[model samples]
Structures are given as C-alpha cells and as structure tokens.
Target chain A: MNVAKRNNVTVTGQRGAPVVMLAHGFGCDQNMWRLVVPALAEHFEVVLFDYVGAGRSDLSAWSEERYASLDGYARDVVEICRELDLRDVTFVGHSVSSMIGVLAAAREPGRFARLVLVTPSPRYIDDGDYRGGFSKADIEELLESLDANYLGWSATMAPLIMGNPDRPELGQELTNSFCATDPDVARVFAHATFLSDNRADLAAVAVPTLILECTQDFIAPREVGAYVHAAIPGSTLVTLDATGHCPQLSAPEATAQAILSFTGAAP
Target chain B: MCRTEQEQEPERAGGDGSLTQDAAFTALLEDSAVDLYENAPCGYLSTLLDGKIAKINSTLLAWLGYTREQVVGRMSFTDLLTVGGRLYHETHYAPLLRMRGEISGIAFDLRAADGSRLPVLVTSAVKTGTDGQPLLIRTSVFDARDRRAYESELLRARKEAEEARREAEEARLRAERERERLQNVLVTLQRSLLPPVLPEIPGLETSAHYHTASPDRLGGDFYDLFSLGDGRWGFFLGDVCGKGPAAAAMTSLTRYSLRAAAIHDPDPVTVLTTLNTVLLERYTGREPRFCTVVFGVLEPEGEGFTLTLASGGHPPALLLRAGGGAEYLPTPGGVLVGVLPHPPFTRTSTVLSPGDTVLMYTDGLTEARVDSGRALFGDGALLDFAARLAPATAKDTITAVTGLLHGFGDGLDDDTATMAFGVPASGAAGKPA
Candidate 1:
C-alpha cells in the first residue's frame, strides 16, 4: 500500500498552468485518468490520487458506516486539495464524483475556482417530475448483472452504459482501472454509485462550473445536463459531439479543451 | 252507393268465387308486408343502383338520427358510413356488388343518432327483374359491437401470452448459459487438482480414472501418484463425503496437504496422519469435515515390489493374483481420518508378483442403488468383479471396471474414482498377450 502511494503521480507539461484535481467515479480509482492525462498535462497542473479503499490504498481503512454515504469521499477530495494548499483549483469529476467534487467545493468555496463535470448524473432513479433515463426495472437488471458477474461487468456493461460501442476501445482503459481494485471493493462501490441521489446539492455549488455532457450518453442524458444547468445558478452547459458515457476516454482532446476553457486557463 | 248498386251486376251467378278469394288474399299480404317492414328485428332498406334511398324502414331511420321523409329520397347509403367506411364501400363494395350482383357479411361502421360510430355487419343484394335488367338493391344491417369488442380482447390477451412465453424462453436461455459457465469452471478446477497423467514408474503397471456424475457439480474423489524419495514412491486415493463447492474446496485442501506432507516425510502412514491432523485442526468444531483415505508407499525389491498400505475407514483393497483368483488385503480397525483426535490407521504389507493387480475404489461404486428394492452392488459384487478379471493388467482391469460402471445405467448416482496397479510378467511387458 505504501509503495503504490510512494510512486508519485506522473505530471507532465510546464508547471505554471492551473492545477486540475481529477477525481474518479465509483468502482474506479485515480488511474482512470491515465489516457486523458497526456493530452491535458501539457497545459495544466494535474493531480491524481486514489480514494481510500481503491487502487493501491490500504483496504483495512474502509468502514461501511463511515463510507456509507458519498460525503466521506467528498471530504477526502477537499482534504487532498487543502493538504497541498492548492488555489484556484479546477476539479474534474466523472459520474458520481462529479457531485462529490460539487459538495467539496461548496464546503470550501475559496479552494476551488471552477468545476468540470463529465457524464455527470445527479440522480440515477427517476423522480415525479424528472426522468433520469433508468427505470426501476432497469436498476434491477443492473443489480442482477452485478450479482452474477463482477470481474467482467464493466466490459459487459460499458457498451450499454456508454451508449456507443461502434468506435471500440471506448472506456477500455478506464475499465482496467476498475480491475486494479479488489473485486469486493468494486462490488460495494457499484452499489453505492447506482443508489445515490444528489440532485438537490447542485444549487449549493458556488464555483464557476461547466458540465460536459455527451449528446447521447446513456449514463447522463442531455436533458439531465439541462437540469443541472437549470439548478446551478450560473453554471455553463456544453454538449460534446461524442456518444459514449466516458467521453474523456472516447474523445480526450475535446474534453481536455473544454476543461481548459472552463478554468479560464489558456489552452 | 247508388252507382255501386247498379254496377254490382247480377250479384247472383256463382259470384266469380276464385277472383274474390285472390283479391282478399292479396290485401292480407300487403298489410303484413307493411307491418313487417316497419318492425323487423334488423334494419331493412332498398336503394337504387346509384345508392339513392328509395325505401327505408322506421327502425333504419331511427338508428340514423333521421326521419323517414328526410332520408327516403334525400340521402344515399354511403352518406351514412364513416369517412373510411365510405371510401372502402366506394372502392371495394360498389365494384364487387356490380360484378357479383350481391355482397354479404361485410363489417362496417355507420354514423348513429348522436354522431357516434355503431359497428355493424351488412349484407346487400342487387335485385334484377325477370327481363335480366338491374333494379333496386336490398341491404340488411346487424349490430356487431359485441363481436368486435370480443375479438379485440382476444387479440390483446394473445399478444400478452406471447410476450410472457418469450420472456420465459429468455430466462431459460440465461439459466442454461449460467450452468455451462459453472461447468467450465468446475472442469478446470477439477483438472488442476489431479495430474494430467500419472508418473511412469519403472516396474509398476498403473492406471487411474475419475468419472463425474455431473459437470456443474464437483466430485469429492481424488487420486495421484508421485515420486517420494530415493526409489520410493507415494500414492493416495480418497473420497470426501459431500458435493458442490464446499466439497471441491476440501478436495483441493486434501490434495495439497498430501503432497506437502509427503515431501516433509517420505513415510506414507505419517503423511496420512499429518493430513488427519490438518483436517482436524481446520474443521474440528461446527460443521466438521472428514474423508476416508488410503495411503500407500511402494518400495522396489529385487524383481518386483512390496507396498505398505494404510486405511482410514476406507474400502479394503483387492488383490488379484496370476493364479486366476482374487482376495481382499486385510487392514483392520481403521476409522475415518478427521473425526477423532488419534484415529487408529491400520497398515498391511502386500507383494506384487508377475501379472498381479491391486484395485482401490470409493464407496460410490459398491453402494450404487439398483432398482426400487434398494439393492446395492455391495462389496460382494466388487469382489466377484475382481475375481473375474484375475489375470488382467492394471490398465485392462480399470478399463473393464469403468465399462461395468457404465453398464449400471441409472443405478450409479454418485461420482466414482478408481485406481489400479499391477506388475507385468517379465516376458509379456510390452504387449497384452
């Protein structure tokens, strides 16, 4: 565990660019941003770290009672930024961590200057007035698949969750990040990610936020991006041309440019 | 009245009887026709070939929200149909009626009193005079709302049943795929615990076989033969009690411990004792596990070999001699390996002469149930089997036994594992002859 942390994160490019903190979705750790790093690193300061029960972090530290809600993960993002004493931070999050970063930035508004959310979905289940694209039956299908096959579920569910597999190798490396964690940890995170609902917290985020929505993303539909834009007072909403859940891996250059533009950093 | 009396010429003269009767009958028929037309069970009407209303009944007028005078010479039959129905009648019903001189049982919708659609079945026939010239058309209409509703319901229920059947088929396919996946895992795991092929000992004729009753569930029987020390070898055959993943785990544990213990001490009896201790230590309390194992150490002597055999509540090994007879090797007072702290394991010595074979098997073979009477193949049957194949080599003996096991049909319910060893005659080593 110590050795993995000792291998310092590989940060490229000139150091003057604003440091961007990259956080991962559930069932994945920091390694998911590996493919996106080479493209963004040339113009930004990149920071990556594993959530406590993920990647190479110590597994003994995980407690069901503590990490039951995503608040525990949200605090860790804020703590990492505070430990480094970073300013004007641009926090980029994928899936559930998108809102995690939102909660963290809302707590310490001065620490982060901007937020970039990719394939962000605030709620997975449907509400009375909102359609999150998943039904109660669809969630049960996802649960059965998780119960049956955990090791290869990302591979099986990627094309379904991504909404487009014809391009191929979309999110393949990001899914490999899932394999690096223990299977048991992946199971717990899968439950936590799909069951969380945080639509109400979008209004609390005070940073200048830009949500990167894939036009045909099965995870977060275009309408959901509009919902986020509607709730977050002055947040910018931009739609990517790509059609998968993880457009960061599908079209990294476009995603990197969007993140750079949102932070007001010269790309 | 005065003119009628004068015109009534000669009321005498038999009174043209036939003519009076015809006049009275014709008057009665005309009255009945008018009554039936006004109160018929179904709507009845006649239209010209051009579809102009020439005659209509009271019932037909009431159904169409029109009075008899309003429709009798004003509207056409097609005007009473809905838009699509009118189009269908124009394109299909009119052309077919012209050719066939009649059309019947055509389903259609008609505009009703409240401007709502009333589903109806209609039959129309074109009338022709005796001169072969077309005249007016007679049409009959019946209410069909009940039948239409019933047909729609039946179609809906049939569609729902088909969807249910498709879902069941998909679930069955998923279940089959899951079973295949588990079987593949079990086969791979089962292979890992046993040797692909037994080690080729110089003077020993050895062969082993494992038969799985089900591919998806793992069998608890296992066997292996490997070199122990300088010219001394060790082999063991054992059967755990249960089935499924738990038994598979025990099989793996027993196999690894036997190999590890044999490497620690070359003695077969001591290795079996060590495995007993391991099993006792690991699974002694709740849900304790036990197996019946036979461990043997074969040492080379002069022309042939001698073996030291120990039994842990397992079946007695059978020895077949070259003299065309077989006997059971005695290892008495043995108990199951993991049940007690210090279970007594009995050891015995036996020599393999030229063309002599020894067989070891699990109880799955002998205890196989036969018929409804619950008769078992039993120890007697196995002994008889061995005696019948007295002069056979180890390979032939195993081949014969496996064939016999296959012949048990439905009797053999559990998995079977058998191991046999023999010493070839010095001259006939290469060929069966």
Candidate 2:
C-alpha cells in the first residue's frame, strides 16, 4: 500500500524541461501509464502517483468524512503539484481523473500549463437538454445489479463493456483489475465518480488543452467528448479508433503519439 | 405453446375474413395476459371482501414461497403478515382502505416460507364493476427493504445531531446560572457593608444609591453611613481594585473598621489611619489587594456643618454651594492603602452651609463610556451635572445621579456608588426646581 510514494520517474529525451503529470481514473492507478510512459518519458519528465485509496496506495488516508466528495481528491492534486514545485505542467488525465485535473487546474491556474483529457465527461446523467448514454432508470438498474451481486461485480461488469466485442477477454482482464480494489472503497469511488457534475468548470480553463475521444465508448461517447471540447476554450479534439475505456492499454502507441505531438515533446 | 396453437386452430376455421381476424386477435390477447400476469414487477393479488385469498399472480406467489394450490383457497392475506403487521392491517389499514375505497404505500411486513420477515409497501383498491357495487379487493405490493434502511439511517443521524445540540445548550445554561449565583452573593455582601437607612441625622437630608452595570456579575463599589459617638456622624465611600467575592469581603472589613475607629476619635484622619493598618496587616502576601477610600466626619456648627474629609487614594469630593456653584474639595497627598507600612492620609476641613450638597462617588461614574462619537463621561461631566442642581437637597442629588447612571445605556461597564448629605432646600426631600 505504498503506491502514494513515487516509485520511478523517467526523463529520457529532455533535461530541465516542462513536466507531464499523469493522473489515472477510478479503478486503476499510475500503472495505467506503463505503455505510454516509455514513449513520452523520452522527452518529458513523467510524474506519477496513485490516489490515496486506489491500488497499493495508503488506505489509511482515505477518510469517509473527508473524501465523501471529489473536491478532496482534486485538492490533493493541487497540493502534490505545490509540494513538487512543478510549474507549466502538462497534466494528462483519464476517465474521471480528467475532471479532477480540470478542477485542480482551475483552482490554481499558474501550476498547470496544459491539459490532455482522455475520454472526459462532465455530466453523466442527462437533463432535459442533455443526452448521456444511460437514462436515470438505466443507472438505477446498474445500481441494483451492483447490490444484487455485491460479490460478483467484476464478473458481471466485464461483459457489459461494449455492445460489439471483438475482444471479449480484454474486458474480462480489465474487470479483473477492478475486483482487486476493496469492495467498500470501490463502492464509494463509484458513487463519487458517477455522481459528480463539473460542467460549469469547462469554460474557465485558461490553459492550452487537448481532448482525446474514443470512437466507440459506452461511458463517454463521441458526442460527449465533442461537447467537452466545445465548452473548453482553445481546446483540440482528437478521436482514436479504440473501443474500451482503458485506451492506453488497448492502443498505447496511438495514445502516446497524440500526447507527444500535442505537448510538442520529442519522442 | 401447444395450448395456444390448439386455441388458435378453431379461429382459422371461420370462413369470413374479418371473423378470422377477430379470432386471431383474441388468441394474441390471451398470450399477452399470461406474460403480464407472470412477469410483472409488482405483486398483484386479489382477495374476497372478507379478506380471503382468491387469486394471485406468479410474482406474489413466488415472493411468498407458496404454489398455486397452497394459498389460493386455504389462507387469507392476513395470514402472510407478521403479528404487528397484521394488527396494523386490521386497525388502520383495513378501515382506511374501506372508507377511502383505496389506500396506497402503506408499509407492512410479510412472513416468508422460512419464517423471515419481508418488508413491503402495499396499495389496495376495491375493484368495482359497471353498477358501482363493491367487488373483490386487488392489491399491489413493492419490496421496501432499501427504503426502510435509508429511513433508519436518516433517523439515526437526526437523533445524534439532536443529542449534540442538547449537550451544548445544557453547558451554556450551566454557565449562565453560575454567573447569576455569583452576582447574587456579591449583592448580598455589598448590602451588608452599608447601613439599610443612613442614620436619620437631625438637620440633615441624607440619601445614597448604588447602580450595577450588569446584574449577572459582581462589582467592586462600596459605601456606608454610620453614627459616631456624641452626635458626630461618620461616612465613607470607596472602590476596591478588583471584583467578585474577594472585593465584597474587603468592603465589609473597611466599613466596620472605619465605624469602630471613629467612635474613639471622630477625626477623619485618625479613622483612615486605623483602617490603613488593618488593611496592611490583612494583606501581606504576594499580589496584595488594596482600595481607595474617602472617610468624612460631620459635626453640627452655626447654620452649617463642619466636615473633615480624609482620602486614601480616593477621588476628591464634589461640594455644591447653596448659591449654585460646584467645585472639588481637594484632599491631596493620599496613596492607595495596604501597599506600604505607613500610608500618608490627606485631611481637609470644609463647611457646608445650609441647603448645600456634598456628593461622594466611586470612579465608575467618571469612567463610563457613552456614544461612539463622544469621549468617556468623565469627571468634568459629573462636575457640570452637580453645578446644574446646586440648590438641591441630598436626596435630590442622589436621585438625579441614579437617573444619570441609567441614562448611560450600555456605556456603564462597572458598578457606581453615590452618597450625598446636605440640608433640604424646600419642603419635600426630592422635589426638584
């Protein structure tokens, strides 16, 4: 559970250069960057650490009272940047971590130079003017499934990943990683990631940004990624031919190349 | 599936095309009824008017762990409920549903096959046909396990918050009560240090008043008037350096010592010197306590009184002349008592003519703060107040100063003690000009 500690940092291609801080999403930790790091670390100094409750990080730091909201996670990101004295950081975020970084960068604009959002979503529940993939009733069914098979969440969630699965076992291996997290911690994080709405913060980002969209994703669809790009000022939108949520694991070469070209780092 | 095909075969034998279509539609309706009755999410059940179970859907039957033959004719709907749920159904649920012809979302419990209780919400409605006659009762049921859990959590949080709030309020109340008790003890001790009514000195109108800034806290002011030997009167007013029960104890000692010393020698200087020795002996420890007192002895003279005043670090007395002039009767070279072995006590003699008032007050009056824009109501303001009513009696001066003390609003942050003795100007004691 020492994932909060920085294990290894690679700065292969450049010295005394701008930093690229990568924050992972709900289930996975900093290990999600194993494939993309070898390519981007050749040019930029890659900073990685797990969220306190995720992976092998310190579980004692996760407090139900304090971490009841996503703001606690976002504040930790800002404090970590301050502790490392990182400036002009090109923040790379995946899944729900994208909004976490967006909030952190909005709170302190001077710390972050740019943002590379991967499969970002603002509001997952649709209002009258919005159309998220699932309806409220569908989400209720998902909650019921979670409660019914409290022990078999991973086995059930794997098959529900995509409608057309050319790689069915890929979803199973990815869900196997999800089951590694403590069920209680996973439950709280599930509520926090799905229930948060940061749509208002999309326009306030004053940094250069790039948003990578999956062509076929059940969670964050192409329309949703396009909407995020439209709301954020001066942000570029790039689409990749990946299907599943863990794009770096599904297609690492394309994801790393996009990050390198957007950051203008030699790879 | 075979039964459905057998039922649809006779409909295909009809020669007319429209008749054949009607027969096929009837077969489709029957198939949909089986699906709806078996797979519906809500529990549907029917009971006789007397509460006997007549028919039930597959959902309700599966929930109760009973087959079609077990409960259809043998038991009533109340048989599936727990003891308390059954009682409520009879007393509250049955009567309300009967009077209203419908009742919805009434929470109850049902006993399952394994004797475990199942929480459920039920909505029962009396099914009536075309003639408006009461028929069988149809009820819909929903599982309430999740709602009940949520409700219990909300109740727990509410009870915890209420307990925390009550504990905080109790602490505040105890603090307030302690302050009130301290103030009561101080007021009782202060009264014991002064005479109830200033000895009814002949040819003299004497009056005294004490004003407290806060009734729930103690103050350090003291005053008294008592008879010396051979028709000479002794009086003193002083303010201690601190507050609470300690100040009240010192005020009592000072009042008694001055009264006893003045009997042997009615000179104000000797009376204060005796008090100084008593105070210095009583307070010999580190951080010794002390006070400022002004002692006076009044003796009858021609058309006026001879007043000898002695001060121990006390303010000068204000002497109001009969013809409307006010000035401080100076008694200099006085230091606070109890700080040293021998303290210098200053004595001065002044004759108050008839119809003149002498006012002795604690510094609380001079140090009172008023409006935000003005300076403190200082000694100059008090002198001007005394001059405005020069031709007033002792009672008039005392009453006027008491009203002035109240007029300070929240400005008077300490206790005030005032005593005035003089001959009356007119008929009544407090009849103002």
Candidate 3:
C-alpha cells in the first residue's frame, strides 16, 4: 500500500549514517520537529513523517474502527520501519506519540535501538495519588475545545490557511502547512491521546530511554515526567528550561543537544 | 450659538473669521481620536508574541469586569479563557496564527472576573516589525451571545430531522419483511388444497395441470383422479365462486364430500346429488357459497373405457376421437350446486376407443381476457384449440393446451385446472407414449 506515501515519510541528512526517526504528537503533524531537525541531521540520518489523518498524508486510509485506539497508531509506526528496512534506530516522540513509540518498540525490539520521550504523560487524568496533572472533567473540556475550533479545521478555510495566494510572501512563510487536519479525524485522535493510560506499558521498555520535561508545561507537568522515568529502569530525565509543552520549538538547541549527547552523535 | 457668532464676525472682519474657524476644527479632531479608541463598539487588545497581554482598550476591560491595573501586565491571553479555551489556544489557535499570520471569526468563551462565560468571536493578526519579524499580536473581539444561541437552536432542529428520517427507513424495511412472510404462508396453504401427485391408472394415460393467477391470493380451482373400486375410477374438476381463504375453505368441503359420496354410490349423478345436499346444508346464509363441477366414472370395456359423466352448471366436457374429430358433450338443464334444494344434474355417456380422450376443465380457460382485454377467449376458441389436437394421445393434448394458455400472458387473469384421460392407440397401449 505504499507505506511511505500513506504516512508522508520524508528522509534527509547523510545517507549511511545512523537513523533517527521523529514522530509528532496529536494536534500537529511532522512539521512540529522542523525547528530541531537541522541540528540532529548534521550527525545522523533524520526521518520525519506525519501520522495518517494528519498533514498531507492520505486521509482516505483512515477508518474509525482502526484508529479508535493507540494500537492502530503503533501499527503505523511498525509498518513504516519495516517498509524502510531500518535497523538499530533511535525513535523520538512528542506528547501522545511518546506512548505510541513505547508500543512500537515493544512489538519490534529488533528495529529500534533507543527512545526519546519529549514532555510525555503516561496518563493525563489523576489516578489515585499519581498526579497526572488533570481531572477527568478537564479532558472532556479539551474535547469541547476541539469542537469550538471547528471552523478553523473546516475544508473551506484550509486553502486560505495553507496557501495565501493573494500574498505570495505569506505563502512562502507557510511552506509546511502546519497543524491543519480534518476536524472529524482530529476529534478521534484527540480522544485516543487524552484518554489513554499507558502506565503499565512503560515497564516493558527494554532500550536506553531519555525523558525530556519542560519546567512549566501545563499539558505534561514535571511530575508525570518523573513518574515515566521511574517506571523505566536506568532511564535519564532531563528538564529543559522552557515554558510550554513543545520544548523542541521553544528550546530547539537544548532539545537537539540532549539527543545528540545521548546517542553519541555530536562531534 | 457658534453659528450666530461666525455669521456676525464674517460681516465685521472676514479674514480673522476664517482663521478662527480652522483653529476650532483642529481641536475637535484631536479630541475624537483618543475617545474613539477607548469606547469603540467592539473590544480590542494587543499582546506580545508569547500571548502576554501588552495593551487592552477600556471597552474590553468593562466586559471582562477587570480594572486596568489588575489585568494589563498580570495575565496572558490564555489566563482570561476557560480551561477548554486554553487547550484550544495551545493546540489549534496559537499554532495556526503563528503559521498563517492572521486568523478570523473563531468562537471562544472568555471567563469573566465574576466567573461568568462571555461568548465571543475573535480575529487576530500578527503585527510585524519593519525588518519583517513578528513583533506583537493584534486582536479584535466581537460579542456573540445572540449568535451562539441561534446557532444551537438550528443544530437541535437538524438533529431531530435526521433521527426522524432514520426511523422512517426502518419502518419501511419492517413492513416489507411482513409482506414476504404472509406470501409464504399463502403458498403453503394453497399446496395443501391440491394433490401432491396424481394417482397412476392402469392401462390409461392421464395428465393434469393447475395454474394460479396470483401468489398473494389462493386460487379455488381443484381437480383429482382416484380409483372408485375394482376396475373402475372416479374423477372430478371444479371451481368455487371466489378466491382467497373463504373460497379455499369452500373448495376443501366440496372435494371431500364428492369423494365420500362416490365411495357410497359410484353412479356419477348420485355422487353429485349427494355433494349438492352436503354443501347446501353447510353453507346457506346471506353470502351463499356455491361451485360449478363435473363428475365422471370410468370402467374398462372391450379394448376401451366407458365414461359416464354428469354436470352441475359446469362447462361441457370436450372429446377428441382417433378418427380425427372433436366436439363438446353437452349436459344441459343443470343448476349450480349448493344454490337449490333439489337441483337436477344432467348425465351423459361416451366410449373412449384407442387414442380417444375426454378432457374436463373449469371456465377459467374460455373466460380468459384476450385482444388487449377487449374480449374473452370464449368457448369457440377452446373448441378450435381442441380440434387442432384431435387424434392425439391424452398426454399430448394436455401439453398442447398448456402451451396455448401460456401464450395468453397477462390476459389469463383467473385460476384454471384441466385433467385428461384416454386409452392408448394400438401398440402404444399399457405403455406411456
């Protein structure tokens, strides 16, 4: 089925170098890693891809029964790795994708070498005293937020947002078409992301893992980072001096430097 | 008052009056610019690139119920929103505005200072510096209390319409299933009223066919050939007055009574007289049930069969001879069964030599509509059809008549039943041709 085209896979940097696959989280596409790609690509082969139902990937491949759970997304990751015949690779995931990588690596341990989880949460809602940094009602509020921005993701506004033909300069600035997706597809992805609890799955990680946490992230607080680090034995947790959940965009240099040091790719 | 002063000054000193008017106009313009920014109809706010509120107009402040000192520097734009709105701003709104440089007509609800939600539509644009770098964000907010209420009402009505359409589709499917089930029951009942297979008569060729016009309604035509005793047989063909379950019930009664009466007395006239008494005793009310029937008895006699037949207001039986001739055996002055106390049934006799056949049928054949429903096929057409098949065996004659009936197509709108029997010609005797 052409896995590379279905997932919009793009490969760059030096050929024959060690491979580093970057996976984006919910709400945005692979363009979220654009800021940190150049630095990582200098020493390693960098790979970026959008999940099905996001970015320019084929939307027709999406089905509600298949994509209703995180396992479907994990299957996409495993298939993409198999399609490329990648071996001993390092995987970087953001937000909900961090859990997805854990699932993929566990299924095909031979394909992946190391894991990097950026501002991830094993669970978003508070369970017992775990302090996942949100209540059950708060996640429902996030679903309402998705509905409130219905007009933004509608097809009528997509062309205007993706390419401003009236102003060519604006079009040049928006080369990647960031964060625009079908509203129905986005809703299902949001439900799978925010409601999933992967606490038990974290113990199955067998590779060297690095968990990067932002100092003031409301979506994934420092507590969730510590929980993920403690759940995986011999995992290192590094707190970046950033304010938002997306440290790759907010603090790209530090995010890339941490990855380069862990993989021994930096000169 | 100003107009009166200007008019008097123009007459006294025209040059000084023009200079005073220009000075007053400049003062009015300066005052209005500042007032318009503070009290515009919609709210306006400007924020830093990171969403920290840098400046806000007084009209927006009044709607938020916050003083200038409390909000100007202490809160970011996300802080003023509800929990849901903050998530939306991070995931969809901020990322889009950063990429597109401008976004318009997005719905959001801001939590006011008193814990109330104020629905509003927001439009934002990035204000760039001279070097083509983003400096700050400029936002305009419009109150949407009335619009949101109207939108919810429209959404509710549309949902109701979709649900009703789904229910109607389900109802139509259920009714179709019910009709199919009823048709199955009618077909099974119709089979019970006819014999599964006709009995084989020794040394005689026999064949019968029954055609029903509608699957939904049970046809009332019936025919049977059964042995009466040693070297003799009794047979009958009839049609009840109507169709469906009521006619089917009357047909069942008529068939059983004729069989029982023939067992008691194999005489064709006496058997019919007994059936007439049984039907009249059973069905005699405002809606009297009656039928036209022909009964006959056959016995072997010197290389042929002797046939004695009686009619009760039924169509005359047709005879085809080995000598290449065909004609009807008329039994006149007969009355319909179940309609009178002592109706006289007419009796007749004929001999079937080798290859000679006698055929009994209901009026459904002659009464069939033809010529685009303009006229009936009539008794004359039946005689012509029988004559064409003269000198033919019993089975061959029946097959030819069946084909002619099929040619009528939709014109054959009633149920029909036909039975034929004869002695085989010469060497063909005792073996089917």
Candidate number of the best lDDT: 3
TM-score per candidate: 0.54, 0.56, 0.76
Across B1-433, the per-residue lDDT of candidate 2 in tens digits comes to 3456547786655357656666787767766877787768978889986677898888887888889798887877878876445434532355445545777766677788778877787889999878986688999989888986786577568768989999999999998899778777766766776677777777778889988776755677888887776777888999888887777778778777887888878688888888889988898788588899999888887656789999999888998888897999988899887786888887899887778889999988888887762778988888999999787788889889999989887888898899998966543452233
Model 2 residue runs over 4 Å out of place are: A1-267, B1-31, B159-183, B426-433
- Point to the candidate with the largest TM-score: 3
Which is the better candidate, 1 or 3, if ranked by lDDT? 3
Which ten contiguous residues of candidate 3 chain B have the minimum total lDDT?
Answer: B424-433
> Which of the predicted structures, 2 or 3, would earn the higher DockQ when compared with the native?
3
| Residue pairs in collision within model 2 | A13-A42
Candidate 3's error at B119, in angstroms? 1.6
The residue-by-residue lDDT of candidate 1 on B22-80, one tens digit each, is: 57766666668777888777888899866778998887777777888878888888778
List A-chain TM-scores for all predictions: 0.82, 0.82, 0.92
> Which model scores highest in DockQ?
3
Off by over 4 Å in 1: A1-267, B1-30, B45-56, B67-103, B126-137, B426-433
Please list the residue runs of candidate 3 whose C-alpha ends up more than 4 Å from where it truly belongs after superposition.
A1-24, A28-62, A79-89, A106-110, A133-148, A152-186, A248-262, B1-35, B130-133, B194-433
Q: Per-residue lDDT tens digits of candidate 3, residues B161-194?
A: 9789999999999988988898899888888877
lDDT of 3 at B130: 98
What's the C-alpha lDDT at position B181 in model 2?
Answer: 83
